[model samples]
Target: TKVADEKTCIQFSIRRPKLPSSETHPEEGVYKRLDVAAWLHHLNELGQVEEEYKLRKAIFFGGIDVSIRGEVWPFLLRYYSHESTSQEREALRAQKRKEYAEIQQKRLSMTPEEHRAFWRNVQFTVDKDVVRTDRSNQFFRGEDNPNVESMRRILLNYAVYNPAIGYSQGMSDLVAPILAEVLDESDTFWCFVGLMQNTIFVSSPRDEDMEKQLLYLRELLRLTHPRFYQHLVSLGEDGLQMLFCHRWLLLCFKREFPEAEALRIWEACWAHYQTDYFHLFICVAIVAIYGDDVIEQQLATDQMLLHFGNLAMHMNGELVLRKARSLLHQFRLLPRIPCSLHDLCKTCGTGMWDSGYIPAVECTGHHPGWESCPYGGTVEAPSPRPPREGKKGPKVPRDGFGFRR
Candidate 1:
C-alpha cells in the first residue's frame, strides 16, 4: 500500500441522494417539499456525478447516515418554507392581504402581455412601497418588509425560540438578501427555518456555559483540522472575531457576500453545506486571503480599524469560495485524510467571544496584522485622557480570554 512516497490520499466519490419535493409527495410521506430543480442544478454546478459520489458519505453532527436514492432532496424540503404567513405581523397585514387578493383575483382573464405588465407592477410596487415604505403609508411599514418577512420572523423566532440569545443588528442585514432571493414569503420562511436548525447549538439553554460549548467545538476542530484553528488566530486580531463579525454571523453571509456572489452561495448552502460551512469558511477564507495583505495594509491603528471596518464590505466571496472548494478537493484526494464538517460546524455554533457564555472561540487580538498601534504617540490614537474631572479613564470589559476593547 505504501509503495510510493507521495502523500497518501483517499479518493472520495461523494454521492448525495435526491431529496423529495413539495409537489411530488403523497399524503403520508413526511410532508415532502424540497425544491428539486434547485438542488439538482446546485449539484450540476458542483461537478458531482451522483453515482460516483455514493462512495464518500458525509459525517454530520448526528453521525453519518444514508438515505434512499431519490430521498435526498426531499429530506431538506421539510425545512424549507413554501407559502405565505401572518405569524409575526402586527396590523398592516390585512391591507397587504387585500392587495394580494386583488392581484390574484384578476390576471385569470388578462391577456399574456397584460399578465406580464400586471406582474411587473406587482414587483415594482413591492420594491418601492412594501420594502422601503413612503411616509403616507407609515401605518403599513413595520420593521418587517413583506419581501423579507420570513427572514424577520425566523430571526426573531430564533431569538424567542432560543431565549438565551436574542436578536442582534447584523441579523437584519443578513436576512435582507435572503428575502430578496426567496419570492414566496412562506417558502423563504421555511428555507430560513432549515437554515436555522444547524445553528441551534449556538444558543444553548439554562445554566448554559461558554467554556463547555467552545471547548467541545475546539476539540471537534482539533480532531478534524487543527491548522484551521491555528490559521484563524494568525489574523493578528481576535482572529475571526476581529470586527464582531455580526454580518457573517447573521443572515449567514448574506451581507458579507456581494449580491451576485451571495445568490450562488445561498443556493449552495441551501443545497449541500446546510450547516455553518459557508459561515466559517467566510472567516477562514478572509484571514487566508488578506494574511499578507493585512501585514502591508494595516499600517496604523486607524488604518487597522478601518481595515476591519471595511472587511464586511470588502470580501471577494467568489475567490474565497473557489479557494475553499479547491482546498476541500485536495484534502479529499488524500488516501488517508478524511473530509469532515466538524471544524466548519463548530464555528457555526460558536463565535469568538461571541456566545458570551462559551470559551471555544475565545476572541483575543493576537494576530499582529489587525492589532491597534501600541499606545505610544501616534496622532491617530485617542487624545491623552483630558484631566478626568473625578472621572475614570474608559474601562473595557475583558472576555475570559482577556481581550480588551
Candidate 2:
C-alpha cells in the first residue's frame, strides 16, 4: 500500500489527544483536573446561580484538564457565553462557521496586488515565527509538519480577516498554544478572534490603545508598590516605559511562561470575574516576586530588563496567580482608589471594588451631574447647542468590517 499523504499525516497528528490516555483515565482518578463530566455539568448549569463564578474559580485555581481545554476554551473566550443553551451554542457555532467561510472566501478572491503584500510579509515575518514557535513540542516538531502549515494558514487567514490590525510579531506565539489544544482550524480561528477582541486589544498599529494600557499598568504599579515604582521612575524616562513588560501585556505572557502554565494563566485571566485588568495584577505579582532583587541589586533600567528576561520561562504560574489575588485584595482595602483606574475598570465593565462600593455610573456626556462623578465623566452625549455655521464635527473612521480598504 502507498504511504499516507502529508495532509493525512498532519490531520492525524493534530487529531491525536494532547494528553495521554493514562492522564485522562478516570480509574486513575486525577481529582485536580476538570473532566468531561464536570464540564458538561457546568455547561448545563451555565448562567444559573453562581455557576459562572464556580466554573471560573475551578479553572483559575486548577486549570482545565489537558483533555478538556479544547472544549473549555471557547466558553472562557466568550465565543459561547454561559447563558447560551446547548442548542443555542450549536446555532452560534454554525453562524460563526458561516462568517469564517465568508472571510476565507474574501481572502481567496483578493487581487494579485493585494495578495502580494500580505504574502511577502507572511514569508518574512509569520513563517519565520511559525518555525520557531513551540518547535521543541512534539505537536510542531519535524520537517514539513502539518501542524506548522496549519499555524501559517491561520495567521494568513487572520491577516485577511482583520486587515486593520493585520499580522504582527508575537501573534504566532499567541495562536500556537490555542491551536495545540483546538484541533479544528476554524474553531481555533474564531477562538483566536474572540481572544483578540477581548484581551489582546493592543495589537493594532494604532498606538492609543497600547498607550492607555501602559498608563494603566503604570498606575497599577504605583498604587500597589510605591517604592519600587518610584525606584524604577528614578532610573530615567526609559525606566518608566516598563518596556520589558510590553510582551506580557500584549501577549498575556504566552512567550514568557511554559505552554501549560501560559494556558492556565490565560484561563484565569479570561475569568474576568474579579476585574477586567486582572492581568495587570498578574504583572504586579511577577514584579513583586522579583522586586526585591531589583531594589537590592540597584539594577538600572537595562539591568532590570536583563533581570526580567532571565525570569522568563522560570516563573511559577500558580504562585504568581495567588500573589495576584492577594494584590487585588490589598487594592480593594485601600480607602480611596484612583479615578483613572476606576474609570479604566468601569470602561471594561469589571467590578473593581467590593459590592458595598458605589457601582460605576455610565456618563452620557450630556448629564450635568456627571461632573460630580468620580468616574472620569466625558460629555459624549451630543452638545445641547448645534454646531456653529461652517464648522465641521469630528469625523468618525468608517467601519471597514475588517477589510483593508
The numbered model that scores best in TM-score is 2
Error of 2 at 149 (Å): 1.4
Top-lDDT structure, candidate number? 2
What TM-score does candidate 1 reach?
0.41
lDDT of 2: 0.67
lDDT of 2 by residue, 1-405 (tens): 112345332110101112233212121222356677777776544332137776775665566888978878888877777777767777877888898888888878889997887788664688788998889989899999999998988888898888777788888888888899988788889988888888743353355777777777777777667777878789888888888787787777877788788877887688775577778888987887666667765676866776677778777776676667656645544434444566555644434444545422233233355556445533232223221222232222112101110
- lDDT values for all models: 0.37, 0.67
lDDT of each residue in 343-401, candidate 1, tens digit only: 43334322211123211222223336745423221222232222212222213211111
- Model 2 regions more than 4 Å off: 1-33, 45-50, 121-123, 200-206, 348-352, 359-405
Candidate 1 residue runs with Cα over 4 Å from true position: 1-166, 199-241, 244-246, 273-278, 297-305, 311-314, 333-405
Looking at model 2, the pairs that clash are 365-379, 365-380
Q: For candidate 1, what is the lDDT?
A: 0.37
